[model samples]
Target: MAKITKKEVEHVSRLARLELSDEEKETFTKQLNNILTYVEKLNELDTKDVEPTSHVLQIQNIFKEDEIRESLPRERALSNAPDRTDEFYRVPKIIE
Candidate 1:
């Protein structure tokens, strides 16, 4: 089993600005040791023939093709604007 020292746990807690009680520190020490042990076990796996991957499944972009297309005319684009000038939307002044 991997062993985690009380001092190491205390150091980590201090770095994270956590104030843990004695009982909590002991609990965390055991938990961290267990996590290390689990990782050590994983190191025993034979992955020489396995391929490393960022994700388990294949991923591909699902976006539509980026091609030029006809857009709405200016009159149609601004038809529903609550306020507008000749070529732009008009909004209330926000800054002095």
Candidate 2:
């Protein structure tokens, strides 16, 4: 991999609307290069037998099974509605 140069760092900072001093540019260039070097080292690892996963840990669904249960009656549910039909609440039309 090509080493990150100060000019490339300066260009990126300008595109991001950031103002960096000469020292900051030098620092970022070195830091980016070091990160690339480390990533290059990872290419030497053998991952052929490793299975790809979204997460490192084994995950399973923790949810309980759904059960049928008694619920509030429709009349009681619509008791406080300002406007309601026999089975549902009513609201003013705002789309038109």
Candidate 3:
């Protein structure tokens, strides 16, 4: 792979709306080059037989069986509210 240049780093920084110093540009050039080198190394791995996967481990949702249960009456449910009408709790208006 070609070495990452200072000009390329500056161009990327400008595209990203970043104001990088000269030192920062040099540092980023070296770092980006190192990252590309590591990626190139990874390209050498044998992955022909390996299957592509989104995650390393299997995921599953464990849930209890749903059952019908007794529920509180409307009046009992609204007993602790600061303000309520015949059916629903009243809250302060939040939007115009």
lDDT of 3 at 25: 88
Q: Give per-model TM-scores.
A: 0.43, 0.41, 0.44
Clashing pairs in 1: none
Per-residue lDDT of 1-96 in model 2, one digit per residue for the tens?
557788999899999999999999988899999998888887798999987788877888688669977889889889999999779788998699
Residue 69, candidate 1: alpha-carbon lDDT: 86
lDDT of 2 at 28: 88
Comparing 1 with 2 on lDDT, the higher-scoring candidate is 1
RMSD of each: 11.7, 12.4, 11.4
Pairs clashing in candidate 3?
none
lDDT per residue, candidate 1, 16-95, as tens digits? 99999999999999999988877788778899999889887798868978899889999999999999999889999979
Please give the lDDT score for candidate 1: 0.90
TM-score of 1: 0.43
Candidate 3: list runs displaced more than 4 Å: 45-96
